[model samples]
Target: MDRIDVHQHLLPPGYRAALEANGVVAAGGRELPDWSPASAEQVMAGAGIGSAVLSISTPGTTFLSDPAQADQLARSVNDYAAELSAAAPRTFGFFATVPLPDVDAAAAEAVRALDTLHADGVVLLGNARGVYLGEEGQEALFRVLDERSAVAFVHPADLPGPAVPGVLPFAADFLLDTTRAAYLLVRNGIRQRFPNIKFVLSHGGGFVPYASHRMSLGIFTQTGRSPIEVLEELAGFYFDTALSSSAAALPTLLTFAEPGHVLYGSDWPFAPEPAVHYFDAGLAEFPGCDEATRDAIRRTNAAALFPRFGAVPAPVPEPPLLTRLRRRARTRIFRVIARAAGRR
Candidate 1:
């Protein structure tokens, strides 16, 4: 089955340089790399991935303390993504970024991003300035997404809270933030009211799969809803296989979410090795899955989320140069494997 990677990221050249100039860093304090379109294409081709939907990784637009700067940054980044998509119609697509602290600007940007730029969706942090997505003031953004039938890609961001003195922010905080945002959305009726907008949670919906029972208990004791009811609502949500590729986590996720609700993603550049390793592990562990189920997760489901991908024809017969390279590479690898097996 052809694969569609729903959760890949591209750091626009301007944005990457801006972050470095400001001394901003990602979860591990690692400086952001310039992930241009060429670099992304190379990684995708090497991994045999057909297409990737790009988004700005963490520290997105939220870093600019100045609202005007943030707004311009968002526009520039989205424009860059649009241009990249124009250049490589099949291999690239993108989620628009918004300036969160300024909701009015964000809403305006959403319209431009969706209507003008033709973005597949909008990317948002799980929490911004301690305010989760379902917060009273943030309703405007959700309303916009609902009106547009747009997808919201939720990634965890660090929030103001107690933390282990030296522990890495992503170790547990990222999952906690995602759980908090999702819980707020459920508790506040955002899903019920804004059913048109699709929410795709990163990191396998974070802690939702594990703490769902507790969440159910709380809801029952506090709001009189059953666990099954909550789980059913959650099932409507989409999840991506970023870092949650563990044997334990994948089975639990599969049991809770249908194949159609799960999409393939690689949290590229940040931890490409882990993302690639996890995808391989998931396939091996879920060997019993039917071809349709595998195909859905690998490509079809993602195509449903981002329809432009469906429009792009898959690569045709390989160019002669590529064909020759493939043959030579395959022959060399086969010979090495045969020699190693004979020695063994």
Candidate 2:
């Protein structure tokens, strides 16, 4: 079916070293998968994926305290991904990872990654340090992305609170992170304001489809926005089928998500090869998933978001004046910094 896996993870050599040295072993409560380009290719081929958008999943470089170290590691990972993309333009593309909480550095890196390296999109951890998405400090970075109409791939991270004794974080906590980020984006008006940026929620939007009305009503009351208005905003997210292509997940997602918003994702490495087969089998055998729906999930929907993969680019509407102004100011500042760095 020529599938595009939009939610794959890539662990670079330096990234792995940093995680281990920092005493990090698992993400979302499961052991990290053994990963390599060769192994990823084998898995993709088995699952019939034609291309994969790579990213670093939860517990990203934010584990490192020093902004210097985090910044360097982000660049290294993005550069490594760029090299892979250059080698095989058709098989691989990557979402650039940035160290958050340091919003300026992240904004700058977003520019370099999207404008210069041609990254497919940017991967943002659901919560950065302790600052979740749609909070005060995130404006600058989100503004840059809104300007570019970038694809913001939201991945789960370990929650800020201490883990409970029994439940795996990925199994439960990760879903909350995704839900929180999505709701907060709607609450802060970030989703409404940044009409151009396509926000992709991983793991079928993490209980969003099933609980959207619950979220929207609460948000509408809190923000004093009309219920239907808030409902549209809540429904605006793009969802990926990563660890979420089961008979259970797909039906709800297919029913709720807007047409052309659901994309294929094989949460690789973290999901391992065997797990990939299991979910792919489920998706293939989903009785409700007809050829049209299956094909849209596999490729067409993603192609709408990412034009390089064959789908026509959706026309971007003009940004409002405030967004335009913010974009211009950020771009000028970014240029000055770039020139200063080059001089050094």
Find the candidate with the highest lDDT and give its number. 2
lDDT of 2: 0.84
Model 2 lDDT, residue 247, Cα: 86
Off by over 4 Å in 2: 311-344
Per-residue accuracy of model 1 over 64-84 as CA lDDT, tens digit each:
889999999999999999999
Candidate 2, residues 1-344: lDDT per residue as tens digits?
37889999998887888899999888888886788899889888888999999999877779889998899989999999999989988889999998887899999999999999999989998898878988866888989999999999999888898999998898889999999999889998898788888999999999898897678668755876655566556667999998899988887787666667889998988887888889888888999777777777888888887778786745433434554575467446545544564476
**Local distance difference test scores for all models:** 0.76, 0.84
TM-score of each model, in listed order: 0.85, 0.89
Cα lDDT, model 1, residue 180? 84
Model 2: worst 10 consecutive residues (lDDT sum) = 313-322
